[model samples]
Target chain A: MKIFNYFGNYFSNRETFQEIIVIPVFATLLAIFLGLLLLIVSGSSNEIALKALIALFYGSFGSISSISETLTAATPLIFAALGIAVGFKAGLFNIGAEGQIILGGMAAVIIGFSFQLPFFIHLILILLVGALFGALYAFISGWLKATTGAHEVITTIMLNLIAYRLLDFFLRIPSIQKEGRNDPISKSILDTAELPRILYFLDPNLRVHMGFLIAIFAVLIVYWLIFYTTIGYEFRAVGKNLEASRYSGISPSMTIILAMSIAGLLAGLAGASQIAGVLGRATPGFSAGIGFDAIAVALLGRAHPIGVLFAGILFGALIAGGRQMQVSADVSLDLITVIQALIIIFIAAPVLIRKLFPWIFR
Target chain B: MYFKKFLKISSGAFAGVLLMTINSANAFTACQVTDVGGVDDKSFNQTAWKGVQDAVAKHGIDSKLLESKSETDYEPHLNSMVNAGCDVIIAVGFLMGEATKNAAEANKDSKFTIIDFAYDPTVPNILGQVFATDQAAFLAGYVSAGVSKTGIVGTFGGINIPPVTGFMDGFAWGVKHYNKVKGKNVQVLGWDPDAKEGLFTNNFDSTDDGKAFAQNLYDEGADIVMPVAGPVGLGSASLADELGSDKLKIIGVDGDWTQTDPARKSVYLTSVLKKMDVTVLSVIESVKSGSYSGGVTVGTLENGGVGIAPYHDLSSEVSSELASEVEALRKGIISGSIVMNK
Candidate 1:
């Protein structure tokens, strides 16, 4: 009920609500319309396009099982995107979320496989270790930017390469690699550390897990941190005007470092949740560009926590439904990527969206 | 009168669609979930998909395919195929071993064949298609040894997995077999079968690594190079084009390079074939005939499941004597007289 009330209050703000909610919704519809036109122009028949649309809808939301899959896919996105949103709020473009997630996931997996603790304690320790690893990895970029006045973008991109190599190296270790497998595959995490499936009692096939609940909890905590906290105020203030925030006794360097650390922590949790909940073992390229996708998620959400949550789920729906579209209509999954790119384009140019949908703005 | 005619045409089209749907409802549906490499990879994924296409044409069965863009897509794609009521699902590549196992265990009613991986305990509903590619690679190795002007042949792998090493091991053994038979010295570079270690690019997509490996082998006095890396072998082909066939000849893997790239036909001596299409089609036929059972199906020379492709443009360079010797070696290996691993 409290959550409902929070959403209600958040939606009641007319000016930001129209910009955040209305514009994005229209943009999504427009992108889908354009995507259909693209399919037709690309030589797919009208009948096939209609089947794809129907299959996409049925796969995403028409069944309880599909909704479960969507939520499962969204769980990691929500965590990572929240982290990116925080960085955006602080006027930083931290592209190192990929490295942070990889490092965090690596830490979580090592702890998850090596330890033999009770269920509750083990899971908590894994998540915390993951966050700490992510924080330290992201801290390098933050420290560089704060101290040397170096750009975070360049450092973070370089760090991502290191992280990828580091994962490859770690997977090769005799202890870390799965037993009897020469290929670079990791040991499965202990069941005690697993994030239990939420709806297993109802249906064994439903895969949505406890990490999704943790994501929602993280959203609430981040919402409280960003909107109702002093640190968040400093972050926003520094973002709006760095010199003014520095003059107002909000040390810009400290704010930048702290904001980046918080973002890293969330991204780390994203990695941990994915390892603990979905993929029981880690492999090379396991994060699968989720960190990069979070950047787009944060942009589409306008750097708001609630908005990020919706955007994550929306992307998750595309992924889950994209499979159905492929199976039922024989459409390539690249079409979904095209649609997503289009939506982000429309979202980035809000004035264009408003001009296109004038009645909605009025 | 115009409205009545419009309604009649629309209803006729609707009835035709209904008839088609009913026809397909009874048709055997075979689905495939490719590895991260995708369907048009021109290697295992493409070869395995060819089996489905062949089955579609021969048996008039319905078929569908889902290309996995990442490792995470495996389970979901497999489940989607199950939900779509596919009679059999063929998962391509070793990377999908775990996901295919889990899916097979959960959906026992559905038959499954996983290329390149066989389960340990063996799931009752899944058939693991394991190939004796070493047998074919051995034949290619003997031919390489027999024809080498430099008295040295080289090979490298994409990774140190069993499938890749199996090819390496057989090639080395074949070279050794040639030395034993002819009383001549032929050195095998890039692999030590006894030590079970060799040069690896650690990835299958990098043509640069392939080119570099081929260059290094050539510098080391190897006249022929075989790359077990998937598309990475294309790098070696390109290098051979630059160096000319007199300097270096190449051996391809998974599919016949001569057929895959007809323009570069001169560069390839003979490709070590895995015969994935033959095995994949056989698996589907088993399902259609209600004889599908879970176990390992080994593809070997005796069954035409794995062999060496014919030397295309390089046939003249490979003496007729060496060609017959390769055929003899093939028969010897099939009869268990010529052990692949020395």
Candidate 2:
């Protein structure tokens, strides 16, 4: 506690507001600049690429509807990235966000079908079930890491593969599949069970759901947990130096398991949001690469809760603008992924960008 | 700093060069392809794009292509194209059926054709061009039995939807008919024509899912496995390519597998062919010549719309007697002597 306040005071006068936001914001510009270079090298028009980039930004956040869409996308990303971010901060990389999400989503699917609760109750039930599922999934990896000294990276990746197969097999079980369609996807959640759109009173065309608000609340909770709580201090302590933390009377084994479980819960919520809020049912690979993207989001956000929220929104904007990119400038949408990859690269080596954009940091 | 500015200027100039394309007609405005996978998918999207290019060649229509990043894209991309003054729109996939349907109704004058989804005209401007992938798949299934070292055969799809289920049905039925004709037993698994719904991936995005299914089939001792999903079909081909075992082969779909896999062409026995390019080209031709139809354009083997692919490297491997048997099977299917089911 003393360390936080004393350290906080030491850095209190470090930079202007523009310096802090400007560096990351300008890092994005540098990334886009590099992305344009790639597009030119790939034999595409710079005019078209510029138009697409502009269109992506405008289509995602320029209009009220577009902003809503970005929030819709960002909502799930915030949960997933925050989940991964916690693990990242703890120095335990969780690569099974996809599987954890799939498992969590499947749990939500089962709950969504079996229950006949009130709207809020149903939503809470599904989220809790999804979170529990993700926590359990992460726990296994944690267990393996805690007991067998298996690397979290390798174990989590393998667990992701296992989760993929398990989800596929589990979706085939008759009780889970949509009736008649007997398809891999579960039956759609009931309309009442669905996460209600806050903007329905305004316009149905926009997809700004209650989940986005929930995601914001989740970010605050995570921030508070990490910064204010006693357990959070133990987690960070262990993450910094396991030997030192163990000597400081923190149970390394328990922290490892608990941290992973919490991480899993977030990932689970990510999937549950998609099911109850976005897609309304569990479809195979429906989580797509959101889990992996969360890693990138965490890296770009510098593993901070507040940064994750903004980074998630930016990533969400990219997704929301994907169609506009194709429509306006005739540029391929895959460039978004490339640009995302570049963000990670640039953020990892911010010194390079810092050198290039001295005015940004200044 | 001067050198850096000069570098940026040179890049901008180079970017300008890439924007250049030859324009032969003032009226030939460009159109873009929202290929769900990519242009090189060698499946429905690629076949339809071929037709688009053919139409472009015949009528001097200007166009380009853009692949879809994810499923959420269907509506926004279609709407964008419509807003951009694209006269005719072609979206490939059953999932995009809804998008094209919505876009067609919204943009009534804008002509749209969608592959894999056959439906009655909701909006007169929209043409749902669906293929009987089952008809072609059945032809391949029957041929598989003639060449199989093992009695077990396999087939899978992107989803249990009508188009995919139809292919599974025909393939399973074809194998059954082949057994009946040869007075032998053949067992097939994975896709059941009689089932209420089929086992499927639901979306055609992943090669890994298809790979798992194909590996399962091969492990279970199936001599041949056919995958109906676009890029997903390449999954089965990959397994076949990995092994030199003639006992395990892939029956390709859309275009010919033999043409696609020249390296492991010997192990790729045959394909259930859907001539999407032919169907799409005809639609474009009809529309261009002012004879466009509003309803479903069903492609059946009976109409030469779908058929069995030619055995390439496996041509010599297939006995002359077996080749003749495949020909007879195709004829029997077309003549209604063999009925592949709903």
Candidate 3:
């Protein structure tokens, strides 16, 4: 009854709830409608398009395995999205999450394969090293922004290229690379370092692991930092008005650096989680554009922690469902990307949604 | 008016949903999961898809393809195909070797074929389709040397991967062979088979890098250039066309550039064919006919698995005597009389 009252009180706060929930839901529906329109324009038969949509939904949540796949896909996006959302609160755009992710994952993999420790300590050390490396990588850009006024957008993008080349070069080292393979393949992490599967008893095919729980905990921690902490207040103040924040005795530079460091820490955790929990080994293109996609997740989620979580899952469902759509209805997986782009566009331009469905605003 | 428009759209969508509920069943379904290059790569993935399409036409087997945007998509795509009841799954590219092997091991009943790679301690349900493209590339090399008036030819790769370097090695060897027989020094630039190093774009996707590398090679007085860089080679072909046929010639790879990109036919000297389509079609046919077996099927020059494409418009430029010599060289290579450095 107490929990029900807490939820009721939360729901009774209509404006905040609507801002956080209603707009995203409506934008998603509108995007799907436009996606169906795109399918029709592309000469897909009505039945085929409908079947594809059904397959997409079913593939996401049809069974326990399907649900597990969705969660698995959502895990990394959630972590990365939360990281992006943290930066958004501080008025900083960390486009370098992709590089940070690669570096962090590489750091985790190095520690994961090299060490011989107990399971609990090993997992904690791996995650810490991964997050620390990610933070350090982002701090360079943040420090540059503070001291030299070099725009992070340009610096982060350049850093991403450097990170890719660095990973390629590092993978070539005979010790780092898997033995007997000249190709850019890394050795698998030791079994002790791996995140135990959550559903191994039911079916070992379920790749979901403790990483999903870690992501949820990160979300709670981020929420607490943003709404219930002093640094969070300063970060928001700097974001809202930098001059006023300076006038009020908040050092904008300090807030910016801390914000970016925290952001990188979260992104790094994403990389480490993916490596330790899902992919036991890193390949040349292992990060797989998830860092870039997290930008969309952050925007669609309205740069809020709870919003980012739901948006990550939504994007995860789209990916998981895309394969099923391809298998069942013969639709191209490219359609998922198109739909994702459309959703982001619709959400970004809320006026378009308002104009299309004016009654929703009323 | 808005209400009416919404009603009409909703009705149409409802009708679509109703129609979609009825799906016809097919007897056998063949599915392919492509590498990060996707289906329209105009290279291995595209040619292998043609083979799946051929099976659709010949054996009436239902075909579908799942394109992997990244390496992470491999296992999920394979699992989805298996769960969706695909009778045979074709995994393209060496990047997919591990994922396909694992999937095949798990689902012993499901037949699988992987192109461009093979597994050690082979799984019973999986067949490896690998091509010895160097032999055909040697012929291309010899012919390229025969036609170059500048007495210089160059080749570069997308990466130093084996499948890619195989073409380069054979081309260099063919040029060496040409030099040995004719007693003429035809310089082969960009690759040294002995050192196993060459000019590479370090990536398969960059056309600008391809254009720059080919431009540099052309600037070095090499009139014939072979690029083993997928679509990146198209940049070199375009460069050759811009330079005119008299100034430069391009040796294409994977499929005949003449057929793949007919608009640029005049620039193509010849393509060192991998014949991925033919091999893929044969695998599908075996599955359809219940003759599918798990083992390595080497596509070599002797069995018509790999060969040089017809010289197309450049045939008029080649002397009959030189063409016959190139053919004899191919036969020699196939018969083991002329062994390649592989």
Candidate 4:
């Protein structure tokens, strides 16, 4: 009681705290409560359901290895969600992040396995190429939206389907496919192009890599670009009211195109990070629906870079803990997905959350 | 605030629940990690898990499985199984080869049996289960050749991979063998062993593609069609049902689809069996008996690991003479008197 009051008093000092902080916090709690109820109603004993909940939390942040797992899982999410946030701030719904990611990953893997350049130079080149590829892919959608008034949602969805086939076509090429394997697996990237694990000194098992730091760097850059820069100011202005911003001497088309391109660049880095850091090679569907999940992350974060960072970690925790829950508690992994969907639903309707917990508003 | 009061009460309740002990571990736990097709894909994953269930019912060995939703889940799921201290972890499908190999090396104490893959050097702690599905598929081809009213049988694959092709190759060769034996000019469609080119849907999940391919083969005068695609073959089976067994008969694959998809049993001439469940159960039982060792186990007709299923509802349609000849061919191949392919 005292702890809640103390935190409430501390948070109530800021006007934006209710919408940004309290609402999300309450939404998460409400979702978890409902998830537990779901488990119990679905025929799990009370003890088993409680055990599953504890396993979920413990698997997320219980120890150093668990923390590393959470961070490792969070890396790509943070990168992609930050990109989605940038697009949202410009009033464009860029659903093409998945295609952008696929292109970026494909580009990175080609560069990763093909050349033998110096370590840092090779990695930087691969990342830049990946970012460039993603930016180019997204630029098409932005350009279409700016010039022809085609809906980004439709264009991006179609592009995603094309990207999957494109990956398949590329992977089938004799030069790109792994030697002696007829399967759709690509050649493994060179060691020099690999993203070295950051916690190798602490424990070789800890999979948290340099990508975590880069994701944080991306967060800082996106934060500054969103909150401090003039381009960002224009982006928010266009997002707030596009017709009014155009009348006020801002170029709506330019802002929309630039915002989407930036978004794509960040997402491309995510694909690059996964290839270089975690997977080491591109397989068909290797983006693993991270781009789709990032939409939820961005929405949950209210399309703020800082909020996306935390939301990414929270989602990462859910994934890592979901595995643990499955292993220890013998619960189906689908339960975690249900919980994630519940969280997204609650966050999407913050009014419902605020109404449910009206005393938090007071 | 009421919110704070609720939080306090919940926290207190959670603290109390956290102290409760988890259930004790079971003895001789065998676990499986499924491929992206999942455990219930009516394919290898499902067949492999069936072996574990059979072992549980027979030997009382506890069974568990973690389904891989994507490729990324492979390594993590393997690691989770290792962490859970599973005695034998069965990795289903060839896609899990690298992850299984890495995990086998990392955890030498844990025994692993991977379906559809074998290590080149033979890892000490892993038993690779590779089926001579071609052997069973050869018999299926003979049956198809025998049963086809049009003197032409067709076979196709999901992809140009060896697992799929092995079945197609054997089927084609069996038709050729049947041609030589009966002095009949029975033609094989959709596959040529010499050139190694054939019809492929390039997908294992799309029933639409399956239906189209079957229709094309049937239109080409192939009365019996063998589809080596996993769930995609169900589309052909449904088409066969609509067309009637007299007009179009289907050959099933992986498990005996007559049993797996019993609702459509009447349309099957005979299924090419891979026997993943039989092999998986034997591996688990060997582990239980302390006789488990790491090596590639090739499932062939001689070992009863792979064979053709009984001609269930269509038994009356197949002549006893044809059935006797198939038995002879199976023996002749096992005895090295008959060659399946060039």
Candidate 5:
């Protein structure tokens, strides 16, 4: 009974409850409706489209293995999205997450292969080094923003380009590359450095690891830092209004630098998790586009830590299920991107949803 | 009004779900997972998919395709096919080499074939399909040199990878062979066969970069340019068309440009063909007939795996004497009289 009351109070006290829950749900439904409409317009039978949708659902959450795959897919997104959410809270648009992710993964893989230490210590040290590298990569943009008023958007994009070339250059070096192979592939991390599979008992093929748990913990830490701590207050204050924050004895530059550093740290953890947990080795474009997708995840989550967690899982499910949909229903996987775009469009413009369902708002 | 719309959508979705639940039983299921370029890339992936489609049409085999949006999708896509109970899985592109190797090792019972890349320490269930495309590209190089009025032909790649550089290396050698035979000092631009350095866009998708590379080669006084970059090569064709065929001609790669890019057919001198479809069909056939074995399958000019496409629009441009000369060179390369250094 006390737990119920605590939950009720938690819900009632937050004015953002509707923004965090109601709006996103409504937008998702509307976007799905529009996606079905598109399927029909594209000449797919109603039965075929729905089968594809069901296949997507089953593929994502159908069984233990499927759920494991979903979590595996979501792990990196959770870290990167939370990082983006934290940056958003501080009114900083850190578009350098992709670059940070690459550098972080590279750092982790370099340390992972170089060391021969005990399991937990090795993992912790590699993750920390990876995060530091990511933080330092983003610090360039943060420092530039603080010192020269350079927009992070531009700097981060340029940094992303540089990071790509730098990775290619690093992979070409003889020592870093795989033995007897000229391709841009790095050596596989030692088995001891790998993040042990969480479900090896169930089925050895399951790829989910401890990264998901770490991501959840990061979410809690980010939530506490954003809403409960003094630094959190400063971040939110600066985000709400830079001039007012400066006048209230908050150093805007310091806040900007701190937010970016923390954001980079989270994004870096994402890279480290992928290397130490999922891939177990480094390859060119290993980050894929997860860092970029994190922007959408952050926006859809309304830039809240808890929101980002669920949002990451949702995206992960969509990705995992999209493969299943392709396999079972014979639908093109590109449909997933279309659905994602539609959801973002509806979320970005809430007026349309409110206009269509005014009674729901009331 | 919203409630009515919701009812319509729900009913449609319900009907769709019912239709999807119906399963079809088949004797064999063949699946393909394409690289990041997807199945409709109009290059390697597309051609490989055609082979899968051919198996479905001819052999009554169930077929499915999954496109990888990025590098991360490779493992999952392969795993999904394995989970779906596919009898044979085909992975296209050199980028999928590692994932295919890992998948083949993990699932020993499932038969796998990889295109454009060979695995080291071969696995029992996996067949690596590789093409000696340098042979065909050599033909393209010779043809381009013979057709060049300015005594200059150029070639560039998407990256400095072996598959890409194989085309450029052969093209450069063809030009070198042309100079040795004719005693004419025809210069090849963008690549130095001896130094192994040349121009590359470092990507396979950007048309603008392809156009810039082609333009750069042309600016250096080359009338013929061959771009080994995938979609990037289209930019070169487009630039060739824009500059007028009188000033420039393009040598296409992979599939024949006359068929792949009909709009720019006029600029295509001929294409260096890599018969991915033929190799893929053969692999599927082997799996279907219970004759599949794990080993390397090399596609060379001798086996019709790699060859030069016909000079379609440019057919009139090649004299009978020159056509016979190119054919003789092809025969020489196959018969061991002529050796390609690269």
Candidate 6:
């Protein structure tokens, strides 16, 4: 928490890899170590799980294209993490990234299916529309908070539920949904909407897509906005002391609305990235709790932009590695979730983490 | 701390080796991935897993079931099976069509038997087994229509996917056919096919949602309801059991609900039966013989792929004359004497 003072409206001094990569690497190792202990204590053989872990490593990282999948999973998290991190920096916890993503994805799907445009134009249309829709969604909670003094936590949670139903409903549009059929998912995006694989020359199935580009750009934009802009000052000022920022003539409500809208825009872009760049279509529960998971990323990264980037990478690796781990080790994927929850617990209670590892924290 | 990471990886490896060596001694290998729902789901996943276990006990196959929590779990579970050297991998549900297709293609030499729906591109080393659920659902819909006191029957499905919707469409058609043939008008309310959003918990794991959804239909004066959701369908049965007192009944799907839900026989009028156990066992047998290949395995009423399970508590409800009438409807459906259109 002492890092909060140093995390002022600046760039190079505020960003570092230690909190992101170095810390998370150590944390993940520790979590896995503890997970293995639990396995042995439970009377399950660790040998089986170990081999599965090795296989997972090879499946995700050893192969030339495996890193591509790892990157694929990371890209969305990066966008999502950036969104949530930004939300935290602004002192508004927008836990509705999941809902925003869904809404964004459906908006993208609607645009992707309803119009017939050039490939480049079609792709851009989906991206902008999705992000715009996401901004509009986040604005709802912002409006509620601004008007009725409602807590964003409750409203966002309710909004997520509402978004889930709305996306499912959106997929029912005849042109957007399956033609001549009723299923919760829209038809696959047009070929033009498909985010071209990054390494098509090497192997067509490798998952590198345009979403990765968008994610990196998103991080860069986030970094720039937080460190170099006037809006950034107002945002930080409001988050630090809403009453004082208001006293300083910065409209707290407007800043809150803008912060949430920007955060939601990034989140919606995450959805568009996943659909156009990863999944290629909208389906129920498609966001897969990345929004909630992004909160962990923000905390683990100490709410630093560069740190969130690396944190997103680590999470992407774990998820990417999970399949391989399960295959090679025969360790259940539940182990991964268990490991993630543990890391979050430690991250949430950094003092407990320090207590567990006195030397490292000191 | 670094040493801990090393120990974690090594010790876990040590444990994995020990278990593999032990399980290798088993006779036959059985592997299954439950649809989005786990094995306890009373529908396809549960019935299908039971079939594998039954096959394991009967055939002495060493079986392992991998419960998929979500779509992301598919590739990993299938890969784990392949890593474990499971000889026969059976994927349950049509939603698994694309996932199984992709996994099957990657592991060409590994024999696979996928139940329900085939990928159009088709993998060379996979067996796509689909049942004649339409034929079976027709039977259930007929019975529900026949047994309805209010003449207003109802049906709702989880996902509106073809396989799930196919059952719904066929059920509605069968109900309509029954009404037209008897020269009687039986009201029918089905899950709206053209709803803005498809009605799927997507999880297929929640029984409570299924129950609540069914109760709404029951409250709307539906005497009989058929749920296409797998295990979640049991929720409908639960509500049907409670509310089925005088004006409500539920038609079960996938397996013989009479055998599965014997205690609640009073509420379960009959089940649309797809002999999933037979379908799975046959696929396992083929893999054992080395003839497992990519092709559509169609199960129709002609092959006993579909039918109406025998009445357990409703034996008295179906008089000997009504039983004959049900039998005639089945024959008519089979012989193309009756074509059901939805």
Q: Candidate 6 chain A: minimum summed lDDT over ten consecutive residues — where?
A: A5-14
Candidates 1 and 2: which is better by DockQ?
Answer: 1
lDDT of 6 by residue, A123-190 (tens): 89899999998889998988888778798889899999999888767776676777655566678788
TM-score of each: 0.92, 0.83, 0.94, 0.92, 0.94, 0.85
Q: Candidate 3: give the TM-score of chain A.
A: 0.95
The Cα local distance difference test for each model comes to: 0.87, 0.75, 0.85, 0.85, 0.86, 0.75
Off by over 4 Å in 5: A1-13, B1-27
Count steric clashes of candidate 5: 1
DockQ of 5: 0.51
Q: What lDDT tens digits, residue by residue, belong to model 1 across residues A246-349?
A: 98899999999998988899989999998999898888868888999888888777788888999899888989888888887788898999999999999877
Docking class of 1: acceptable
Question: Which 10 consecutive residues of model 3 chain A have the lowest summed lDDT?
Answer: A6-15
Candidate 5 on A1-362: residue-level lDDT in tens?
A: 64454333332216367778887888877776777678778988766777777777788898887899899999999999998888888888889899999999999999999889998899998889999999999888888998899999999999999999888888878878888655577888888788888999988888899999999999999999988999998888887788998998999999889999899999999999999998888877799888998998997888888989998998999899889889887889988888889889877776677778889888
Question: Order the candidates by lDDT, highest first — what do you get?
Answer: 1, 5, 4, 3, 2, 6
Cα lDDT tens digits for candidate 1, B1-342: 643653465455554443342233346899999877568766767888999999999999989889998888999999988888898999998888899998988888888999999888999998999999999999999999999999999999987889888999999999999999999999999999998888888777778998999999999999999998887888988999999999999998888888887888899999999989989999999999988899999999999888999998899988989888898888898898877766
| Residue-level lDDT tens digits of model 3 in B210-253 | 78889999999999999888878888888988999889889888
Separate clash counts for every candidate: 0, 5, 0, 0, 1, 24
- Best of the two (3, 4) by TM-score: 3
Ranking by TM-score: 5, 3, 1, 4, 6, 2
Query: RMSD (Cα, Å) of candidate 2?
Result: 5.2
TM-score of 3: 0.94
Q: How does candidate 5 fare on TM-score? A: 0.94
**Best candidate (score: DockQ):** 5
**What fraction of the reference structure's interface contacts does model 3 contain?**
0.52
How does the DockQ of candidate 2 come out? 0.29
Regions more than 4 Å wrong, model 6: A1-30, A37-43, A49-66, A113-122, A325-331, B1-34, B51-68, B71-91, B98-113, B118-126, B177-185, B191-203, B241-247, B258-266, B313-316, B335-342
Q: Name the better of 2 and 4 by DockQ.
A: 4
The 10-residue segment of model 6 chain B with minimum total lDDT is: B191-200
